[model samples]
Target: MEHFSQTLARAAERKGGEQNLFNLVSAPLPEQQLLAQTDDRCLAIMTKVVFQSGFSWRVIEQKWQGFEDAFWQFDPHKLVLLDDSHIERLMNDTRIVRNGQKIKTVPLNAQFVLDTANDHGSFARFIAQWPVDDITGLWLHLKQHGARLGGNSASFVLRRMGKDTFVLSRDVTAHLIAQGVIDKPVTSKTALKQVQHAFNTWQQQVALPMTQLSQIIGLSVGSNERQV
Candidate 1:
């Protein structure tokens, strides 16, 4: 819950040989970290997670390369050009989770991202405000139109992709419980809010770019004047 409970912070404070489980988890998969990078990739990661919330992050991480590749490296220009056939093909692509509905929103969400970025200065600026009602509107429309999972958790992820306000990772959740933020191994609302608040503050204080495993793929995809 507390920002101090971040895996890196905990790893620094822990007085044991065995690595903290949270550290072991976060040290490798840096998907969330990418979302906190420059404004451009920040929104790209959010768009990806809009569908990734309900599924296993491992799957998300695994398919991330394919997602990046298929989406033209998350470039607005390339993504906005994706057609219905592309969406249909992705549904049959075994490399990624074949959620037909969620995959369908990728192009539309691209249009939305460009619209938001053009209107609000950057998609990053738009999402940081955390508009709950508007997300409900998006969810209602998505469900009616055929998206699989566009609920509160996914919406929260969309908001969080703009900032590292909350630790959605399970290891971080358990760490918080170990650190007294919760009595049980849980991620409570109060704790999440406090951590989010702290993250917002810290995010405002610095500009950190994420550099994780680029062995598979990179968010640095496309040649569309990326801001990050």
Candidate 2:
């Protein structure tokens, strides 16, 4: 496999320059700040990622204010307490997407946030305590424990919330394949381990966050520009 520095250099050339490449990729928040986030903020991100799955992100972005209002700013305590009437109300509400199944996930995810908090002092703390080197492990945890937080949705949630993690998007997966990190899409436990090890190595060697490394690899493979 090529050294990660070679991969990043290739990406920088394609993106115009290193600065340009850096400008496109997002930086993660400090550990303290990440841990300081309230349960509401975490739940809001989870809800947004959940709703964005299999739907147009533009539509979700346009209706985000409505979502905030409908979910009472995603206050986990209040959301967990909502009854069937609340779900029905949101299902009929025009301001949001009005998808019944997605709407139902909101309260379930809210309770997940609260339940995690109840066990770990706070949801933010639990996530913040997660080691970035084993980010896929965290993703697995989300899939197992959180509602509607499977696959890339879990990664997107962490990325949106300023967590220092990598996403296995199609583009990124392509680059990983090209770099001989994996033979196919990351799915099986062994494949995910290979991907994680590649990222962890790159991170340690370059002193860059997994988020930046992931984006750089994606760019190297000509992936569409996105806010990583």
* Model 2 lDDT at residue 188: 89
Say what the RMSD of model 1 is.
11.4
Error of 1 at 23 (Å): 9.6
Q: Top lDDT: which candidate number?
A: 2
Instruction: Quantify all predictions' global Cα lDDT against the true fold.
Output: 0.47, 0.88
Model 1 C-alpha lDDT per residue in residues 1-228, reported as the tens digit of each score: 334224334333342322432222222223445334444475356555665666787778877777676666777667777778888777788766788766666666666667767777765555544433233343343344323334344434443453322323444444435545555532344554543443343334332211111100121122212221
**Deviation (Å) of 220 in candidate 1:** 38
- Candidate 1 TM-score over all chains jointly: 0.47
TM-score against truth, every candidate: 0.47, 0.94
User: Cα RMSD (Å) between model 2 and the true structure?
Assistant: 2.3
The deviation in Å at residue 170 for candidate 1 is 10
Model 2 scores a C-alpha lDDT of: 0.88
